[model samples]
Target chain A: MTVEAFLPRDTTALALDADEVAAALLDAGVQLTRNGSRGAFWLEPLLEVKVNGERIAFGPVTVEDIPGLLDSLAAEPADHPRYLGPVEAIPWLAGQQRLTFQRAGLGDPLCLDTYRSLGGFAGLEQALAMSSRQIVQEVKGSGLRGRGGAAFPAGIKWQTVLDTEADQKYVVCNADEGDSGTFADRLLMEADPYQLIEGMAIAGLAVGATRGYVYLRSEYPLAAEVLVAAIERAREAAYLGQDILGSGRAFDITLRIGAGAYICGEETSLLDSLEGKRGMVRVKPPLPAVEGLFGKPTLVHNVLTLAAASTVLAEGAAGYQELGTGRSRGTLTLQLAGNIRHGGLVEVPFGVTLRQLLEDFGGGSLSGRPIRAVQVGGPLGAYLPESQWDMPMDYEAFAEIGAMLGHGGVVVFDDSVDMAQQARFAMEFCALESCGKCTPCRIGSTRGVEVIDRIVNGERRDENLILLEDLCVTMEQGSLCAMGGLTPNPVRSALAYFGEDFG
Target chain B: MSAQPSSKSVIAIIERWKDEPGGLLPLFHDVQAALGYVPPESLSEIAGALNLSRAEVHGVLSFYHDFRTAPAGRHTVQICQAEACQAVGARALAQRATELLGTEFGSTSDDGGVTLEPVYCLGNCACGPSVRVDNRVHGRVDSERLEALLAACRQREEP
Candidate 1:
């Protein structure tokens, strides 16, 4: 364990700060590995040197601080960088109880050896040893909910797929994270692809499935490349192939590139896209579990859901289960995005208040203005006001308050953001992006837009405002999918919270 | 004789995506890439191509809020408005950019140099206020520094 302690403020944001940090660490004499960010940007310039069993992380370092750091450690300016600190002690890194994003921000996401060293495929090994029921039980015990927004039970979905008597069950990992404020999925795919692969493999084992496909957004061409390469590596490693580890059971996965449609992030829409159809929302009744991904019993899971499954399998579900509150179990990777300090994925147990997310890790508003409102979930989620900051981060909790934990996306808005404008944006957004599968979402969205515009233009604003509410109700219940249903979240929540702004 | 482009919505998008599967994403990509926008004409075609009704295509496009139909400028300058970028002043930068360009997001400049788009994130978290011009990402772009990046597109008709 000769890995020296990486002192605080030695490493920070990588790549963009790579040259400066490298040149600085060089001045200090310790070589810095310009690796991928583990989805932790606040700890930029984080330098990692493996000791014995663990990799040490030092960061939030700058080019200017290198001289003092090197001299303080008494290391040659180009020799051993000072033992700054341990990887776990860094406050920003320490704060996050990473579950699904457990492997991200560690090292080169492309390196197979690195992934292997970090207990990546060990879950797959465990899955291979267990029966389908046992594997499902393990995930079920873990109480892990989908990190992708829906917070659906991962194990139950897998179990359903297993119960289905279909010959060709499929595992579809929804990596087309089109949410406005979340990039954790992309980060996971890019930084620790093996985690996702391991998650899918565990899913396949539980579901008795033999095929897996990852529908990644085309917006992430680079993540796609990494996933493609990781898939290849896994295939070569016997992690994915006709026969798994000489066991009769076989599971293989393919990378399906999404054209970057937000609707495809929806499971059924994703299935449609995977099936070579326009990314239209599919009506759910059979759900994807019975009929999904080429009309077979498919286990449609989010990247985070599958990644968490790996964690549960490797560490035992109880270990994760014992962490969080009722209904919401284990750690949640809350992508603390939008106008905030220390912005990145902050994984904590469920039940943490939005206030903590905003005031604590987020460090208040980024614009230094009084925070007006926050849009939880994603573009489709409700805009909660400052008064609602006490709301805990739980599915039931959000649901009770007319909101959602959709995809763990937290988009913040300072006072500079106009609620009227954001409200209008909801209808406008719906008008522009709806799949138009139903008349309610299609026609209502246009009508919603017209209503909002009339209000803004001060034309019969009061009557139009009432009509907008009525329209939202129709869209919410009448629309086929989330597009129309959740579209009014921003508008309604904004109206509810920021009514003055609308006027 | 040069082929006169068909005014039929289904005819045009089908012509583009008939060769491709993964209809929604690939078609959206092709349409956006080729026309620098997802035109409504193609939107109807996207529906027919996927065997979805016209309303379905319209619904899907409108639902997501990311897909656009209008034309983009010669160069697309996408400034990440996500949390990481915002922390480094992307909000102010986006405001300045939109103001400087004299056009809102999704609209091309009259001169056709660049169309500024507000992207969520470019995965360049560390850089903060990252901007992608066409395909090249410029990290840590400040107001003064943006000129140097935007200046490169002055000569090009499109990238």
Candidate 2:
């Protein structure tokens, strides 16, 4: 019998030399299958072997360890130093409620047979029989909000697109995940791409859209390859092209790549980019749901949100609604990044406190230093001090504390962090990335950076701080999009909590 | 340096994507992929084919950071400068890369071996500080590892 060995083909795993490990395993006469990451990145390149119907885990593996590891596996697998028992029993993965990411890392992501056998297209199959209104109602009943930082009710957007009478409607997947600490979108697309395809197809059926577009970022080359291949496979299987799944209903998806713009992640800006124009934020009078994508109603959702739609349909609305806290009724895909010891993806119910996620799940700072600050959400998110760690990660709770759980990216920083510098960097990033469509974002960001520099240099520090706050207010209230409106989150939070850093 | 594809070939690239809706971005990407960077001369051809003005095409091209008007070095190296990478010493890694490369960000090396650029994020934040050499992304990078990567880029130039 051929011994089966599994290794992740994830970008992170590749960075850790999983390909080299695979070559060594193949040379040792083992049958190797490339799988997706388990999101336990600290244990990557985590290698697994199927023995006696159970996959045993061995991790942080290197090519040098392969000989000894294979030898141990042949002799007594339990005796291996790197062995971590069955893959299912790992506390980091087993403890969380994985709704949207249920099938992540199970098998070859592109294998349609494996995907089908593992209950992949069940949601799409179910959606095939339902009416458009029923589908929208089910999503509404599930309390599913937009996972793309806005926290807007996804069902309402779908309802608007469904109700709007347009000759052409578009389903756009906002795969331009430019958030700093977030990799969930990239991980999901790279790992379980079919789920996103199914979700987009379902959205098309619900909104009477015959065509869909995935506006992906150019940075994720691996995801692009996987998605391109997966889309082709899906089209060949009749799961994406016209007459999807033999229901005689027509729907198809086109993958468009963004040219590296952070603002394109915004819905209107994404639409603008998809139009082959400058990725400038459009005015919000006519929402994308009404007139979008070349003057047609468009259903734009984030990668995670679209993926969650599949889960909501498969498990039923009540099944998904039973998991989370008020107004946030599903598992949040929290990405632990930066100076954390156990940096990875954590999908848990919304009520879990930031402290539990940072300590229990992440194991605190990687440098063994005290945790100074944690930036939740993306670049536009607030920097939270330790005092607010106990707050639950619900959208309402975060909003109550002047924070938003934008994209659920949790970036940790150690005690050595300089909040003032971080604050300045936030402004500098805005200045660099602003689309030049609005004044506050275009001009105020430059001014904000300069004012922060003056304050840090002790040139009329008190006066500069006040000026910085005023500039932030102008950017917050006057800016056209979140790119400018939310620039003050990191800046204000850094100042409010770590005032000493400025002086 | 590689020979720049002639203007006729550039028009063919534009012709391939001109009919598709929202085709300018993809046209630009294909042009840049075939030729190391989007040539400024092709702007008129792209605009003419797509029924857009030269300024319109130029505006879209210049708006994005990815579409450069000139050819890059033999190898392109990008270091993540986002907040997550910053927390894990990406700033120092970037500094080290520039020092070792003898080139600043957004410039090609003296030997034409590498072009250094700062990227916002690579979505590989957990294992960062991340660095991308050409198409492949490597994580948990440090000064020593960056030197080795740059050394390999230089080594390819010797032969």
Candidate 3:
């Protein structure tokens, strides 16, 4: 049989190119099926070998090692080099409570069989037995909040969409994960794509919506391709069609690619983009549930939210709620990035401390420099000094330190980092990407950049510090979207914790 | 007389919708995707399409830093100005990039071989000092990188 290996585009970080290795293997007359990663960035470029009905995984090997690997495979070498023994044997993976990401990095991302093998469609199967309200309750009981920037409760958003008055409603999956450090949405969608599809189908069933749209970011073209294929295969399998699992429910899913705009990750902005308009933040109060996605009632959720929902419905609410800290139940997919060995996706409990994550699992900074501060969340997330490193990764925990688990994307910064520049970037990024929907964001961001520039250059240093704080306050409170609103975090938090840089 | 949405009338439409809630992005995307950037006449079309006053569209068109209202130089060169890239001399590299293009950020050069735009991180932080020519990303960019990038763009444009 011809062998195929599905290599991810972002696998450019690998020590070996998948294409080259696959080619060399092909030259050796060996068949290989390139499967998608399971959000395990560290294990990538993770390779798998088909051993009987089951598949076994191996390294993280480079192009040069392919010849030796193939030779050993032919000889059935007693001990394979770079073999972590087995993927399941890895403590990092075995330790994870993978409900939503169970199939990620474990199977062929596009293969429907691999998914079915791992109990993928079983959740949708179980979901068909229950009414819409029952499904909503299960999600609500799971305490599964939105895994996007804002950790809003997921079930409530569905309930509102269900309650809204619309003949045609929508379920929008915000896969536009534009945060600097966060790759959970991208990796999750790429690896466990079916989980998202199942989650959306369940949402469609819960909210009484027949149509769903996944607004995936343009930066992640491969994820889009894989998801689009999965969605199609799901349609053919009757898991996402007019009659899903003989439940007589009709749901159609479509994937819309978003232009690279950080603002579109916001719910309303995503709606506007979905409607083929500019990606700009909308005023709340009417809220997305009431007036969203072409002014129709819509259920807007992050990729992680939907993936988790699939699991919650598959298992009872109590099963999911049994895990995690108070108010924050269920597992979280923690993406460890930036200047760290073993940089990849990590799934841990909701209340795990940043110390255990960064130092223990992340293996500290890859730069070999001292750890100064870490920016949890994306670009707009707060720059936390070492003092806050002990803070747990939770919704309330982030708030205590003035940070957020915004999409659970953890970006590490080494000692060589300049807090002042990071703070300025927060403002500059706001100025660059701001939709200009409101005056505070449109103008205040520009002003904030100017003030930050003054502070960085040592011009009117003491006087400018006051201006910087004031500007941050205005941007934080007055701006319309999170682009401007949350941009103050890096600046304010950096100043608060690592103020030495300002001098 | 009911105004028709031609190239000229489109400008009026753009002006009208430019100030409405979330107008620039929808307006920008619509104009750019449809006409390959916000053309002057299409401004009114955008205004009419989005339901805003002409002056409002004009104000927004000028307010935001990213919207390009006119045709740009042949090659689009986006410089990395984000901190991760800056840590590796992205600022100095940006200067080299601008000098090679013979124009500053947000402007087209006289030769029109390149148009320089200032962008935040392209998510290639691990490979710092990154730049993008059109949609392609080049890592570890510097003065030599800028020249090489410019030359490559020139080659691609030719037969």
Candidate 4:
């Protein structure tokens, strides 16, 4: 009998010695297959084996646990200390509304056969039969917005690209996920890369584009390698190359790597970087939709948006639309990080509150202290206090509360956190990453940091606080892009919520 | 420090990627991968081959944080100083690294054994205090683990 064992090849898993565990399993007469992460990070290096048609799990495992694990597996698997029963029974994973990440941690991430057996390209097949207009209508009706912080309606962007008359159009996936507390894009790319590839191909057919580009960040070398292999396999299988799936439509994706530039995550800056120029933000008017990427009509979407596009097609617009609250439809891939105990990815519908996500999914602070504040979104996002934790996590809802859910990255902080210091770091990050295209952002960020320093140092605290607010307003209104515009969100939110930290 | 690639190899790298749309970034990446850093001497060659001025090539190279003019140390150790990592004591860890390696961030150790730098995020956020030693990312890193990693770097450097 062939006893099959599965282990994650994810970065976190590999860091915890999943590779060594796999080697040990192989040496002990077990067939080992490297799989993607289940996103229950606390239980990572989570080993699984096929038992009576169920994937029984044992995890947070080390090489030392192998002998005893195998002994228990042969006799009574429940007897092992690391055993966690069947994987599906784990409440952490079972609670998620995993649409885009449905097939994560199932089998070999590079295995096309495994992907096909588990309903991988069903959406692309559905799309192959539909008209571009009909596809656009389905997407528009689904209410899917860009998941890369900017909640722009994706269908509208696709419609504009389709309506425009250009010699050539392109589909660019902004995989430059530079957000600190977020790894959903990297996880998607590394675990189920074909989903992103399929989504990009669908975008190509919908927008009348023949080429695509995935501007992946250099930080994610693992994601880069996986995407490269996946794109090649997809092209070989006729899912990504000229004449995709015998539909007479041509769409090929080129993987581009971004150097360490946080500002490049901005679309225009990303375009400039892609064109082999300095990553400076461009003025809006010809908005990338009409004139983009080599001065042609281009459809740009986040990795999650494109992946969700494929999901919308496979699961139908109404089915997805029925899941979430007003405007915000379908699921939100909430990435719990920072000082959280149970830090991982949680894909749930929109109405879930911050408090619920923090308590239920994150399990509060990792340090076992009372949670003080949480930063929603990336560095530019606001730090909400405990009082506002009950608010829903929808984009509109967050915006109403002087906050914006840029990306669904919720970073927890314990009682020891200094809101004043966090506010300063926000300005510091902006000053470092500003593209220098405009004055307000380029100059204001540095001045803001200085002003905050004065306030924290008790140098006319009241006056400096007022001056800091004015600086924030100038950056918010005068800056060319969100790099300067949204820097004030965290600063103002911290000052407003935790004023004591300033003095 | 690693030896710089010859001009001929640099031109070959540029020639290989000049035709593709937005090929300069890829060419730079390939050159860095092969030569350890973007050699200042090769800028004129890259500019000429790509039909851009030397100023333009230099601007592109300098704008990105990744493209370095000088070669890095034998091993690159990047500690994540982003908010996610900071919440879990990355600041203290970075301080510990600086003290142990006897070098500040963005500087090579005196022995040229390790280059310590600060990285924003490695997309391993769920596991806080992530560090990347070369291409492999290690998570849940404490000061002790960091010291061991640095010691390993030094051991590898020895004959």
Candidate with maximal DockQ = 2
Deviation from native of the Cα of residue B8 in model 4, angstroms: 3.3
**Candidate 2: RMSD to truth:** 1.2
lDDT over C-alpha atoms for residue A121 of model 1: 81
CAPRI-style grade of the A/B interface in model 1: acceptable
- Order the numbered candidates by lDDT, best leading: 2, 4, 1, 3
The superposed Cα distance between candidate 3 and the true structure at residue A357, in angstroms, equals 1.4
- Deviation (Å) of B136 in candidate 3: 5.6
The TM-score that candidate 2 achieves is 0.99
Give the per-residue lDDT of model 4 (tens digit) for A223-296.
99999999999999999887888888899999999999999999989999999999999888898999999899
Q: Which ten residues in a row have the lowest lDDT in candidate 4 chain A?
A: A10-19
lDDT of 3 by residue, A43-66 (tens): 555666654444455677667777
Question: Considering every candidate listed, which one attains the maximal lDDT?
Answer: 2
lDDT of 2 by residue, B1-159 (tens): 343445666768877899999999999999999888987877877788899999999999999999999989999999999999999999899989888888899999998889999999998899999999999898899888888888888888786
> If scored against the real structure, what TM-score would every candidate get?
0.82, 0.99, 0.84, 0.99
Residue-wise C-alpha lDDT for candidate 3, range B1-159, written one tens digit per residue? 232336653465466545654445545655565555676665566666667677866765654345666767777888767554555567788888767767888888887778888766455554446677775666556688678778998888786
**Model 2: per-residue Cα lDDT at residue A254:** 94
Candidate 2 per-residue lDDT, tens place, A1-503, comes to: 68898899988898877888999999989999899887888889999899999999999899999989988876999899899999989888888888888888899999999889888888899899999999999999999999999989999999999999989999999999999999999999988999999999989999999999999999999999999999999999999887988899999999999999999998999999999999999999799999999999999999999999998898899999999998889899999999999999999999999999999999989999999999999999999999999999999999998898999999999989999999999999999999999999999999998999899889998888889989999999999999999999999999999989986
Q: How many residue pairs clash in each candidate?
A: 53, 0, 38, 1
Give the higher-TM-score candidate: 1 or 2: 2
lDDT string, candidate 4, B48-142, tens digits? 87899999999999999898998899999999999999999999999999999899999999999899999999988888799999999999999
**Least accurate stretch of 10 residues (summed lDDT) in model 3 chain B?**
B1-10
Candidate 4 CAPRI level: high
